[model samples]
Target: MRPILRIFLSLTVLLACVMPHAHASVANAPGANLEVALVTYGPGDVYWERFGHDALELRDTVSGEAVNFNYGVFDFNEKNFFLNFARGRMHYLMDAEPTGDEEGYYVQVGRSITRQRLALTPAQAAALRDFLFWNLRPENAGYNYDYYVDNCTTRVRDALDKALGGIIKAHLAAQAGGMSYRQQTDRLMSAQPWLMLLLDLGLGPYADQPMNAWSESFLPYELQANLRRIRVPDGHGGTQPLVQDEQLLSPNRLSVPPAQAPDLRRPLGAAGLAFALLLVATARRARRVHALLATLYLIAAGLAGLLLLVLWTLTSHHSAWANANLLLFSPLAFLLLRTSWRARRGLAPTRFANGVVVLQLLAALAAVLLHLLPGTVQQNQPWILFALPVWLALAWSLRQAAPPASFAGAASARG
Candidate 1:
């Protein structure tokens, strides 16, 4: 159960690219009463749902059968599900179900659902319906899913663009939104500090690229908001809002997701400074205890570096590649583990180990220097504030430090 929970939670957060799809020709859909609407579900309580979800709804008022076409459905029991997800090849599909079937569940969970009546013409509505029905077919339904580029919200946006003759892309694709993928991710993951920190430590420069509105609409809220401002040509002549009417079916029971990223400077900075001070004080008073604590810290740093390294080299997680964090939380830190263990046993750390510490300290210094350079936008200040002081303290303590047992006897030996 724990493993499954971790798999799904990580899966939801590791969001991705557009893949090609096979589509059948548009068939004739029901004539006049085909109503097309966009239904958006707000962020839910579960970690997997922090990003929210959305679907396209096509209703035939004549037949009274309203089907919601959702592209967010994934099967947990699918073969190689975990493996494929780990390799960044997640498979999601469009599911067409009765609209009424989902409302009850969302309402019970206290998640908000908003329905936007679209002003699409009959022809546009019919075309979209045909495409969605075609998508319902087994071969056409499944798609290669990615987080930021090809998730539920992006899929809905693509379909709307197809029906609207590409207006959404044309207007929003190149228009700068002044936000990056990381900023948006930070905002959504703010409530979960651990996840936010995990992502911050792993993500590389790729996540720092600024997003345009089209790319930013991967969020359901962004898509829903953007829909209001879009203008589609009315049947007569003039332009009209793409959203004809808006109705909120249910209210959000959970707190609204934060709009901005959390500022970690104060907390992380204080913690780092305090920890560094503790290490320095312990080095003066209790060399053995300081050695044990530093050894533990080194082991943890090595393991985290290992995970980040694997994500970069062995996996297809593009966002985690080329991370500058390797400087601060390095797998190379493992080299000092044996030295610290020796120190804990009253033996002195080797000169080579002290040299390694100096190298690590220099590398950490370089990380900040490079970030200060122009065009390098990793947004790693929080991590720098947390890691730099520790590395600096470690360097200071490791150099020319007497063995644990020798510290107390040094005064007598000198006498």
Candidate 2:
């Protein structure tokens, strides 16, 4: 009975040793048909889904098995996930799974899926499959995620470029169409006005520069569209289309609603109304109302300026740097709040208060002149238009309020 048990255990060990080689041999067997495709998913309603997603699909015709290589997976429970995300050091990992498992999630979320079958030779298809499997290994799976440069779509593009020995990039360059990063983002995000506003504020001139075909491939849908036009060398001195066939696997039912046009007039009108009230307050010597408005505006502007300062100096957000909006939303506004409160109490105007009013006027003027400068390309006109008149009105109201005679006499003596 012991000899029989030992013989069974030895056979089990032998089978384990032989199984992997057997599977590899079968997978690469001659005459085995293989297909490689790019699977792209349409954007969903969520903020994170606004960019869409893409993956590679490899189908083994002989085994009738379809595998999906996805590079978009990230664990929320990963060490320092949220912290790293804030620091612009988020990590994403590759995930290889059965095609059905991957498709199920996108289908459930109602995002449209499109597949573009690549016209790769058997050797090329095999190489891509091997490369994807190698990349799926734990050591090679993780990558630093950059939204515009090194995200999921770009990963798939780079992988295909690698498999094709730079042929894909060569084709893309030869047939490149120009589009700036900001233009493409704005077009996609046009359905979300608040998001568009935030992005416009956050992104710098780097996003405004024109993108090459390779840079544009960061977008999944753009890659899908460009793949149709790509022509690769056929090894026989002729070119063949990169995409052999294209199919729409699913239609997006959760369409993003169109963005409502920004009402620039409404904000301008509101500012105008506030200015009118400020004029009336100054005329009637309504120190309390004037002080209240000044304090509120100063506090709001101070906070906004501080946030922009942090985004510029303390973070890895490139787009928020060199913001001219700081000129309009000056942090120095906060320093004047004490004087505003003093005025509300009918106290004599201090020299510091007078200086702050002059500084506010100068800041407003600087904001207006910012757009005319060579490198200040931020579209802060709406903010400038809204806040400039309010600053001027506040300045005028402060000047209209006379200081006590005794305080003025003391100030004159000091001067």
Candidate 3:
């Protein structure tokens, strides 16, 4: 009798806990006249926020319950999170939360939000809702995140593509204009000069390759723009626009005017100034100053080369491989450190130093000529302009510091 009563009590508690959620799930089913929207958020001032964000908002008209499915959520407390991020293997998860709560957070942060209601058929909307719920399941929620390929915006684009049965991609393919990954990134980061420079230095030839329409959708704003132009087949031998309506849910209070065209004058001016200083140092026969400058240049080049090597081989940063900047900033420069030390001691230049000077000149020339090669995509002009003069100056300094030919002849004869 005691055991029977205990089992009955446990069964009652389980039913009470499960019943409400079970009822709610049924009430929010896809067939309940769902309204789907693509929610795009404007960029903020922070570095991470520069690319903006996006999510899929699903509202049940019957139950009046709305949920925002965001694909950008990552737990900082997860094991090996930072390690995975550094290795370019970041794992981001889909999080389905109340639409109001998500919108409130973005509103509080001053990020503008625009919602585009998709003109999906009843069957299409139901399928999309079902897919979103399936993706929200714990076993399927997390996905490997790639910034320029499989990011937050791209995920939503893919989800829509799935629901519409390839209509989005077909529409994008028919579009005319296109830009490379680096070019798009540069356009967005133009307002942040320092950040742009950093990204330019880190990115390689792979980033210069032109992006297809699907790839361009990695950007939230680009996805929004492209989606607006997409038309889905209407089954009556005609097509209809994908976006039914658009609404501005929130306005960015800190929005700034669009950035002006990118100007190379700043980089050229800085490089020119550096070249003038190097010329002055050489003309003044400032041995210590020249040696110090050479050391610093060599160190910078070696570090840049090492970083490029790591990006190419050790990490999953696909866009950073095949770097031509390595030609301008070579780790081989480190080999010249011994030569600089010997010259500072008033010793004759080593045969190795003479060889390094020739190699350095050849490397600089090669870097300058890389743009002429067929299918060559990297824009290494900035690096060439900055590094070429320094290399030339270093070569000149080495030549000046070398032992006279007559002295070399006399020493050889004595030997």
Give the local distance difference test score of model 1: 0.78
**By the lDDT metric, which is better: model 1 or model 2?**
1
Runs in model 1 lying further than 4 Å from the true structure: 1-28, 403-415
Regions more than 4 Å wrong, model 3 = 1-27, 30-32, 234-237, 255-273, 276-280, 345-348, 403-415
Give the range where candidate 3 is weakest over 10 consecutive residues by summed lDDT: 1-10
What is the C-alpha lDDT profile of model 3 across 1-415, one tens digit per residue?
0001122322332243236564343224555378889999988777667788999988877667777777887666778988898788988877766788778978998889999998888788888877876776667877999988888888999999999899888878666537777777776787787788767777898887766677778888889999888887776999888898999999988654254435554675477458646854753366677777778778888888888888888999898988887887888889998777666655656888789879978988998888678888887677777777778777776767754666889999999
Q: Which pairs in model 1 have colliding backbones?
A: 15-147, 16-146, 16-147
The digit string of per-residue lDDT tens for model 1 on 1-415 reads: 0012123322221210022324211123354678899999988867768889888887777656666777887778889999998877888876655688767778888889999999888878888876776666666877888888888788899998998889889878867775678887888888887898787788888888878889889989999988888888877889998899999999999888877877777788898888888788877568788887788789878988898888889887788888888888998889998876565455556878878887888889899998999988687787788889987877667653655556668878988
Q: After superposition, how far is residue 187 of candidate 1 from its true place, in Å?
A: 1.8
lDDT, candidate 2, at 27: 36
Query: Candidate 2, after superposition: displacement of residue 279 in Å?
Result: 8.3
Model 2: per-residue Cα lDDT over 1-415, one tens digit each: 0001122322332243246643432235332377889999988776777878899988767666676777887777777888888767878877765688678878988999899999887777778777776676567878898888888899999999988888878877665555666566666676786687566555656676556787789989889988888788777999989998999998888875333334443665477557646754653367777777778878988887887777788777676677777877778888878876776665645788788778877877887787778876565666667777777776666655665666889999999
Winning model by TM-score:
1
Q: How far is 143's C-alpha from truth in model 2 (Å)?
A: 1.6
